[model samples]
Target: MTVDAVEEPFRTQLTVRLRQGDTLLGVPLPGPCTFTSGNGIDILWMGPDEYLVLGLELSRESSDLEAELSRESSVLAVVDVSAQRNVYRLTGVHAADVLAHGCAIDLEVAPVGTCVQTLLARTGIVLMVREDGFTVLVRQSFSDYFRAWLADASLEYVS
Candidate 1:
């Protein structure tokens, strides 16, 4: 199993627009090029004042999460974009190399907890560096193509 790519669907995904230094939501908004994980959720910094909140718990409903986040006065907007993207877990030692085949970012120096929004295989994606592996978030429309590309890119390392 050289870079296993498994789709993780139905996870709660919220696009949050908040002020840069607001900590009212309890979840720390990570800075550029980083993510903060805790309480079964990961907050990925998408832009200077925007973040993608991913609920690590697969069973959680996006509506419930969205409602909860919406109550925060500091949050400018809480959009439930759960269905807009599909989560893919890419594991194993060759995972980074496989991603590098299409991504321009140098993954070698990206420490765990690093997250960045970029193009992978020409598909826009949000990649989070994790201890076990890497978590890839790709738009649903491009999921199939990205999956095929990942498989093909990792073919040489399967043996």
Candidate 2:
């Protein structure tokens, strides 16, 4: 198949709930339907007061990150949700087409930093649009199902 799926398991993920106008990782939290990346971390806006911080190859443990984040005065909760979800990357020319089969959003029009919580193949996922492809975050329990569904969805593009 032209579309390739790869799983990136067990990277640090933090759920931070903070007061208005708070900042993390030296960058302000993104606005609705958007995400920001800096200092080896990507911060995605999850709600009015919540953001999902994705760490990339950070030298610290999830707990360490949590403790550091919790130190902020405006921070209300800093949870290490690393074990709660699995990440998948879909790439290749047909990637978006494969996603279109199950996702309702028009990801092609969405900017590279766009991120949204939605359902794909009836499974809840946090989808991030990227220049290379797309990143899909699904609950750990539903990862297998989502992978299988992704495989099935890309079948037609195989020739």
Candidate 3:
């Protein structure tokens, strides 16, 4: 199995109540329980009125997004969490099985573009289902252990 810590394009997380006709950086906010992408930016629906934005970490664009969303409401919040987590790209024929060892989520039935917040080895993580693999996002503090666990869990399949 191949498990590598790879750099993501960029991420901007936000918490706010998005309403009809609301747009962030000209991209229409994805409604509840869905995801939307525009211009290479993907917005993951994490919770009601909550989304995690992924794209290139362009400083100027970041500023523009923030400035525009700030007016959404007084409770609207745009936070840059690009550095808060370590993302591991786990790929191989056995990668999904390896994740199932710890994750209770049924990846076998999940769509390719789905993202689920779940636990792996008792650590909170975000698992993004890809066509051939998964993108696992864990907090920086837990990255080392998470990565090690992945290595051990997939040894049988890899070897």
| lDDT by residue (tens digit), candidate 3, 74-119 | 3356777767777667777777788888989988888777877789
Off by over 4 Å in 1: none
- Which residue runs of candidate 3 sit more than 4 Å off their true CA positions? 1-23, 31-34, 57-65, 68-75
TM-score of 3: 0.77
TM-score to true structure, per model: 0.92, 0.93, 0.77
Which candidate gets the maximum lDDT versus the true structure?
A: 2
What is the TM-score of candidate 1? 0.92
lDDT of each: 0.85, 0.87, 0.69
Counting clashing residue pairs in each candidate, in order, gives 0, 0, 0
lDDT, candidate 2, at 138: 96
Which pairs of residues have clashing backbones in candidate 3?
none
Candidates sorted by TM-score, best first: 2, 1, 3
What are the per-residue Cα lDDT tens digits for candidate 2 across 85-131? 99988888999999999999997798899999999988999999988
Residue pairs in candidate 2 whose N, alpha carbon or C atoms collide under 3 angstroms: none
- Distance from true position, residue 108, model 2, in Å? 2.0
